[model samples]
Target chain A: MIKQERAVRTREALIRAAAESFDQDGFTVASLTRISSRAGVSSGALHFHFASKAALADAVEEAAVVVLRALTHDAGRPGSSRLQHLVDATHRLAEALRDDVVLRAGFELSGEAARVPRTDLRVSWRDRVERQARRCEENGELREDVTVGRVVSAVVAATVGFEVLGVRNRAWLAPGTIAEFWRLLLPTLASDAVVARIRPEGTLRSAG
Target chain B: MIKQERAVRTREALIRAAAESFDQDGFTVASLTRISSRAGVSSGALHFHFASKAALADAVEEAAVVVLRALTHDAGRPGSSRLQHLVDATHRLAEALRDDVVLRAGFELSGEAARVPRTDLRVSWRDRVERQARRCEENGELREDVTVGRVVSAVVAATVGFEVLGVRNRAWLAPGTIAEFWRLLLPTLASDAVVARIRPEGTLRSAG
Candidate 1:
């Protein structure tokens, strides 16, 4: 049990160290030597945990996926409006991108120009969004002219854009930045009554 | 005159070859030798025009900027609505990204993690959008609830997001993609009269 616990702790430290390096310098410049040293492990030990840099990035992305799941957990709330589900998810995602290094690094790596992304965080996030937009279409939530595909395109692009800009400037990931997106987008999709009830700041029920 | 014309043509060929290489393999992986070969120029001739890879990339970006100027030149159209100016810019930008390799590669390099970007394509584009959004706020075209900063945030994020996503998928750069963005966002910021007049597909006068 102690050996397994130590193993887990070592893995956690390595992931954190890798996140910091990847976040600061990007994948091409990220140094595995620095990461292992920061994690208080030998190169051999680091390699034992992760076979290569890509493997390490995959682990960071995995840790970030866990964070993403928790960030968007409100989407599964038993009875919330599908529109609200999306609004809250964007807000929570912004919060995560702003506050969490692993998630931030995961996002950076996912969008990096160098690799075939192994983690698929952006694709999964986009898929979840498309699914919810479809639900909104089935109900009476969308505007008369709006289609699920259009909503998906706008929401995905804006959120992903925020994520991209946030790589250089954290302001892009601020709650207000996403709130502005919702404020403009919500009214275009929801009925006046529904729009009134949908909180652009995200409801207390889902604010991370 | 003949000698000077040959030099200009050789420089143009090198820049186009560099852009094609950078767009396909990214900045880090692009080979100078391959670029010169593709340009039908010897290594010495390529070096005479551009000092190094970074210099070549800068040339590509500058050429792309010239394309960008023509792409958004309609912003100067007299008596045009500022909202329409922004809309036309996005549509023309999408078309340019779809059709122009130098512009596309410039965008890729501007967002690239490998170096400090010299061109500032995204920054200049965002600045233009901010300028037009502020104009919208001042002209009573915006709804009472929307603010200039919010408009800038939503518009910049969505448009930049489209540019980034469009790098991989040309569909994101489709005219309809940007039109949908304006379609959803127009009603949120503008009154019914203004919204009805705003062309989501952009104006015929400015269509590229």
Candidate 2:
């Protein structure tokens, strides 16, 4: 148990270090050497934990997925209303995407993984998102008109798109653009009643 | 005049070669040496044209920007209706993004470049789109209710969102999805007469 705990700690440290390096220097320039050095581990130790830079990136991405899943799960915990839960989760995810470098870097990593089929991160991430969509459907949060698969795909695509665009165009959309995108988009997918109440004037407007 | 002509040709060749290399192997895996070789030039010649990989990437992205601008310009040429021109330009851009590896790769390069401060590709792209939106508004193709800036932003965002998503999740979305997205989206922004005839089964349906 102690050894396992230590291993988990080391893994977390590696992910955090890698996220910082990737955000600062980009995917190509962020070397494994820098990640390991920041994590205070030997190069061999990194290799033992992750076979290569691609492997390390996969681990980091999976860890971020786990974090995001945990957040959605927490939002849906027993006491919250379904609509409130979704709204809250949307806010949380958007905020986390903005504030957490790991979540942001995971997006860039996923893009790279998509281009390189050898990286397993894309497949695993896809499966996890699919499972989450199923869970959302089960909870009756999703609209009957929506397919779980389509919803999952749209959610992933929109989230990634908004985050990436925000990061890339930070000057024009310097503050609160990600937040605004979710604010606009979430209601469109939500039940009409929820959609009505989420306006700038705080009054329920007619449906779009 | 002779030296200037040769210099222009070398510059164009270098940009084209670099774009092809980056598209085939991604930015990280593509080598400048290989690009120079593929351009049928020496390392010294490539250096004289572009001092570094980043410099080469910038040229490639600029070329793509020029292509998109030209596309928009052609759509807005004399004798074309403004709204029709905007819609047509969007269709052309979508098709080019789907078919041209160089354009798509340029998108990726611009995305990475934008993350770092001082890269203004995002702003320039948005400005170009906004100009088209203004033309549409003047032509009475769009609703007076929607602001040109807002419409342009949404249109640009959705286009980028759809393409990036399509590329990442290429399997779920069929080859025709890009056309489908625009078909669905264009009418949403168009006047009621255009909106009325845009159903899936209508003769005005988008071509794949």
Candidate 3:
């Protein structure tokens, strides 16, 4: 293998192992030695890759953000209206959570992220939420009565709520359920007059 | 102090210490040794009162549940209608989250409760949501098209979502936000034809 390829492999292995250990055991129990041993590397290797446990955690969080952003990024492509964009984003997020442990690590770090401000991971999620709200405003997806701030707050709150539910009740967390949650919530947050167009092709019963 | 007074003090000490540790760290890290040391008691003394960490956590959870139950239990008392009862219950839950770390701990421990599934803390919250739904049905507070199951699920989901938000964003989780979240959600979840009756006398305004 090339020298750079070898370095990338070692870093990825360390991150994956650390993410798994951190997720299974809450941050307090996620010792570096356990993570290093799990990765089949010496403690020195882990240190060379990540100077501290917090740095390893930050890398895991950054990886998770990259995954989440990728899931939402495609939805904003041209020709998709704001409502379609949101539906697409929600659907993608649900699938991503189901298929990717790295993505789930974002939810795991969410609690810790709350304590530290201005991290790139935190900023990225906030930015995604804000962009969606701004798009809603520009497209008239939300009611005039609902300001961009209110819509953004409500959507952020709902997304966080959905993540918690997804964590606790993984069995019931399907894309359809998340889509239904957005369908119901979006209309309520939007003005009653403009709610019709964004109401989706069929009701939730049909969606189910 | 008298025996009863001494016992009360000890119990309070344990709960306070445990809450502090759990809040600073999390479930698995707040060892009995640390909790006892913080409380100025021997490990044997700690075990004398609570047999194990799980048992102790159970106690803390139960205390939190008691405070939560009190909010909804009295809703059925003489003069309160179902709608009024729900409004009160919603407000009380927000208050509980703000004033009571025990309640906060219960919420934080939700994922843990899911893993163990012994305490069934979720059942009471479910019951409260069901009660509100039943009341909505009786008072015709629901929209003609809404289902009790969906309304109940949304309410429960929002409660959890807002609580998670409270823990994760202490600064942004302002007073009355939880109540407002329920207020915004209930109407969307409820049938609109009679949704006004469920709205508290003067609480529904454009801002909400």
Candidate 4:
């Protein structure tokens, strides 16, 4: 049992190291040998865990999916307004993109043409945003005229833009930046009654 | 004069070749020799035109700037609503990003961290957008409550987002897509009087 736990820990460490290299150097230029060295593991050990660089990237992407899925799940918990849930989820996601190399690398790698990821992070994000927006529409939180497609486009584009811009300037990832975006958009998207009920900063107290 | 013209042609070919290579292979992996061969020029000729890969990237960025500045200029022409000019310019810029490899490579190269650029394309773009938004405010095209900074943020972030997304999906760069964005945003940004007068497809007749 102890040996198994150690192996799992080593695998996690290697994935983190690979993510760091991919995020800093980009997928095309980053090397497996360097990733192993950064993880303080031998090349043979890295090979044992991941047969190739693509496989290692897939593992990193999977780890990111796990983190993002949890954020989405928590934001969608029952009894909360779906629009509020989406607002909270987007804020949490911007925070993750800011603080977590694995999530950031996952997004960057998915965009790189040199490799095909097991899952496309952007597609998944669009799907999630669409799904949440549909729920908001069903809940009557949306204005009578706002379409789901337009909301998805605006949310997805702006959030993805923040990710790219934050690559150079971190201010793009600040909570206030996203809050301001929501404040500007919410009035346009929701009925006045719903808009008043929703907080751009989000109602959930937890920072996560 | 004949010799000078030949030299100019050779230099232009080399710049186009370098932009193509950088766009396809990215800056780190693209080779000067390969770029010269693609241009049908000798290695010595390429060296005469550009001292190094970074120099070539600068030339491409300068070319992109020329195109963008022209678009901005046409949009800001007097007798047109400044807001309409901003909309038309952004659409034209997106079209250039889709159709012009040199311009696209210029943006990608500017984002690369391996080398510092002579000019940052993103900074230039943001400055131009801010300047245009200020013009719109002065012309009384904007609603009283909408600050220039907010307009700048919305315009910069969404346009940058479309560029990044369009790298994978050309649909993001389509005229209809940007028109939709402006359609949604204009109603909130302009007073009812201005909104009624503006067309999301823009009022400008120029193709530039």
Candidate lDDT (C-alpha), each = 0.84, 0.61, 0.66, 0.83
The prediction achieving the highest TM-score against the true structure is: 4
Interface RMSD of 4: 1.7
TM-score: the better of candidates 2 and 3: 3
DockQ (Cα-based) per candidate?
0.64, 0.30, 0.42, 0.51
Candidate 4 C-alpha lDDT tens digits along B42-106: 99999998999988999989988887788788434577788888888888788889999988888
- Give the per-residue lDDT digits (tens) of candidate 2, residues B1-208: 9999998999988998998887666676689999999989999999988888878887887888777777667334665556555555556665667677666667766566223423344455567778877877776777555567555655566556555655555443343443444443454466678555444222224455
TM-score of chain B of each: 0.93, 0.77, 0.81, 0.94
Query: Best lDDT goes to which candidate?
Result: 1
Candidate 1 vs candidate 3: the TM-score winner is 1
Q: How well does each candidate superpose onto the true structure, as a TM-score?
A: 0.91, 0.75, 0.85, 0.93
Worst 10 residues of 3 chain A by lDDT: A113-122
Give residue B127's error in model 1 in angstroms. 0.9
Model 2, residue A168: what's the lDDT? 54
Query: For model 3, how does the per-residue alpha-carbon lDDT over A1-208 read when each residue is reduced to its tens digit?
Result: 6988988988988888887876676555678999989888899988998988878878888888888777777445675567656666656666667667766665666675223422444346657878887887787667656666655555566666566667667743575566556656766666655565553422223444
What tier of docking accuracy does candidate 2 attain? acceptable
Whichever of 1 and 2 has more DockQ, that candidate is 1
Residue lDDT tens for model 3, B1-208:
6988987888878887786676666777678999999999888879888888777778777776787777677435554456556655666676677777877777676654213535445556768878777876776666666667666666666666566667756633554465455556666766554455554322323222
DockQ of the two-chain complex in candidate 3: 0.42
lDDT of 1 by residue, A1-208 (tens): 9999999999999999999998887787788999999999999999999999999999999999999877766445555687888888898888888889999888877767677678877777888788888877776788788888889999999999899888778889877778778878888888898888788888855432
Q: Which ranges in model 4 have alpha carbons more than 4 Å from their true place? A: A74-79, A205-208, B74-79, B204-208
Query: What TM-score would you report for chain A in candidate 2?
Result: 0.66
